[model samples]
Target: MAKVGRIKLGSQGLEVSAQGLGCRDLSGPGKPEPDMIALVRHAIDIGVTFLDTSDFYGHNANEVFLGKALKEDEVREKVELASKFGVSFADGGNKVDIRGDPEYVRAACEASLKRLDVDCIDVYYQHRVDTRVPIEVTIGELKKLVEEGKIKYIGLSEASPSTIRRAHAIHPITAVQVEWSLWSRDVEEEIVPTCRELGIGIVAYCPLGRGFFSSGAKVAERFSENDPRKRLPRFQPENLEQNNTIFERVSEMAKRKGCTSSQLALAWLHHQGSDVCPIPGTTKIENLNQNIGALSVKLSPQELLGLESFVAADSVKGDRSAIGLATWKESDTPQLSSWVAA
Candidate 1:
């Protein structure tokens, strides 16, 4: 197997693996701790040192699990750890709340530090833009965290171009995580350009179209009763049936390229630019290895365009997520003065 390569995440000098491990699924109930630790260790062993997690995932259980995974000597130092704040659960994990007030920012960082058992987080992100709080105010608190050595870099997820600019003006945003896949090309128009202009890295989450390219239409059939994708519009029987046509087109191209549909999908993102890194999450070791193999599936400029043609943004049916309000298009905060007045 080939080793995972490295990349400079942003102008801020934060370097990490070309491919990152999304550690969200490694936590939560019924997931064996020992196996999860082994999965993380395996990724580290193979040079995939960038790990992503969120405080909202499993309601903080993910960070605690990561702390244990990196507890051994030298393990933490070898990893470029990125965890997020801002989103919290209420009403028995049924109600989702986004928060970016200064107090919540500080408290969330302190809590994440404790759970991760780390003195400094490599990269900390405002998982969602809390429209109630001004972007400047939220970023101001994050700037203080950077100065205090609590977090080395800052990131934003699902942030609009204006929000990104405002946040960057307050502090350099090291990265912006968004849904960018073969079927999710909406970010290419404005968000991608803005990040490039501001020297921010793009962390492409769900780069495999949330496993659609990997398993095709059958993916919907495999979803468990409690699977969140069940609620997503794209995965609904009618929409999924329509979306399967797009997958079929990509799968046919992947076979000609001598790679799986998943590899081809990820390879397209890899060809996007050196500044873009895809963090596709998987619980199985085989899937982890497969994701890493994407680094080797090179695509020429023509092949890149060919793949894009197969799954154009309009070609895919349904919204990216069930909650449309959480995407970058809707991720703008109120003015700082308005927030202050309130």
Candidate 2:
């Protein structure tokens, strides 16, 4: 196995590999099962032991798929598995609902545990904040799971800075999974600083900008009808054309640095801080290898600055997701008094 370095998440002593495998896309519709399993195992073999997935992914299929892949006692023992809850479909997937009530929290943990076929999940995240439920209430339930040995740590995904502080006050949030990449720097203004202050680690999902940086915008235009990226504002035709400049800059720097654009992007994230881990997912072994190779692609101070200046936040256009998708701005900083009154 390659010797990728590890970093500590929060003060709980939860350490994971520098790069985690985002397992969400592994078992999507019509994807080959065996290839997905092989890709995950290959990730583990290459020192990518931290796996990120959610219960809602493929409507629980991702967890079940991971359960099968990690069924071997040794394989299960070697990996630090993280899965999430708190998003479900209604009206046959037309309407989306977010639940964080204590009852739902306990039930979700139980279902995920059974689906994952593990005694305890290493890290369990609330996939998205349920605005109806207090952040404290959600973390309180997670705290119970930790006490009962159902989960080792708690995480929040795409939560705002204020919500993170409130949740941490209830229970130490082990990680905050968000979209942090060359294109998406919205979290840096508040979320990243809050996590650092509270000792909460960051798990950067879409660190490659959802293939925008890796494959280029031209290729992104080919997203199929069912592909989720097609729904995102950034991947729309005009926005994609504008975003092509960001990719062009990255590609140019990657060539100068003698690394792939994907590797450069991952390396840029690594340079952000020791507490940040990027989980870039792929179904191909070659792409998995390329992601792992990022561990060795060190960027000097000047190069890091160059890339940062090239893809500054304003350089990219379009919202990170479509309007209805829960975002950090809308979900962060809930009024504690409102929940208290309720």
Candidate 3:
């Protein structure tokens, strides 16, 4: 395949591979350590330098594995590392925590620094919106880190536009990471336009619908019960039964485009706007290559519009997130929901 496309993340002018690598899969998601290392290095060898991970991945295995790989390859400068905080590992697994106070922010950055084995974080993001904590306070703390040169840039994940605005006002928030794809266009109505207006990049996690759109039903079934997707609304059996129509549309479009379903889904996303970037995770080198190849998969104007309309409210099946997590606020002002308490 040709080289992957590259784009500027937010306004920092840091260029990363258009099709970034989701490093979360490297920590025993399915593959072993040796295999995972090979997959990661191979991905970078093929020009995927934007490696995305989070502190909560594999109970902290993601950062550790990435650090080992980066040190082994001696390509710290060659790769752009994007990692997140906010989820605590004190009790095992991911539990939402909104400790964005100045002290917590400094400690988190320092902890991520040690785990990543890097002096500076290429991009540091708050893993989630802490409704209990004002975003300005959280971002103001991040701004201190930026000024102190602890992190090169700041980002937010799954934050509403108002939260984004509140945080950005304190500091130039670089990107917003959300689980956006053909299956989840809810971000289009507000997040997309707002990010574009603010010059913030949109990093799309689960760009393949957490493997729902790309992998066949049989493969999805292979995911361990502990997999986060297993608990998500769309992945539930009943919900999936009703959601297969989305894949049918994908399969049909893939045939016409002469690409895999994953490629079709990713191509459609890239068409959404230049400001959007999707980091689809995988533990296989071949799959990594296939995902990056999506940059070459072209879609017609009619195809784009058709895909959008196809995912309209009537066509979409179940809640994008669990009922509680689905309570999305889409602006730059403070908004509260009953779900935040859940």
The numbered model that scores best in lDDT is 1
Q: Report clash pairs, candidate 3.
A: 161-331, 162-331, 162-332, 162-333
Give me candidate 3's TM-score against the actual structure.
Answer: 0.92
Candidate 2, 1-342: lDDT as tens digits: 466778897778899999999998889677899888888888888788999988999888999999999997579989899999999878998777998889999999999999999999999999999988889888888999999999999999989888988999998999999999998998998999999999999999999989888888876757887888888888888788878888898999999889999999999999999999999988898988888888889898999889999877788889888878887787753455666524
lDDT of 1 by residue, 1-342 (tens): 768999998899999999999999998777899998999999999999999998988889899999999999789999999999999887988888999989889999999999999999999999999988889999999999999999999999999999999999999999999999988889999999999999999999999888899988899888889999898989988798889998888889889988899998888888899999899999989999988888888888888878778776677888888965588888898987677633
Please give the distance, in angstroms, between residue 49's alpha carbon in candidate 3 and its true position after superposition. 0.8
Off by over 4 Å in 1: 91-94
lDDT scores in order? 0.91, 0.89, 0.79
Regions of model 2 farther than 4 Å from truth = 332-342
Please give, for residues 31-149, the per-residue lDDT of candidate 3 as tens digits.
68888888878878888888998887777778988988888647898889999887665544445555555577778788889998999898898886666666776787888888888
Better of 2 and 3 by lDDT: 2
Pairs of residues at least 3 apart in sequence or in different chains that clash in candidate 2: none
Q: Which residue pairs collide in model 1, if any?
A: none
Clashes of 1: 0
- The per-residue C-alpha lDDT of model 2 at residue 333 equals 38
Candidate with best TM-score = 1
Candidate 2 accuracy as TM-score: 0.96
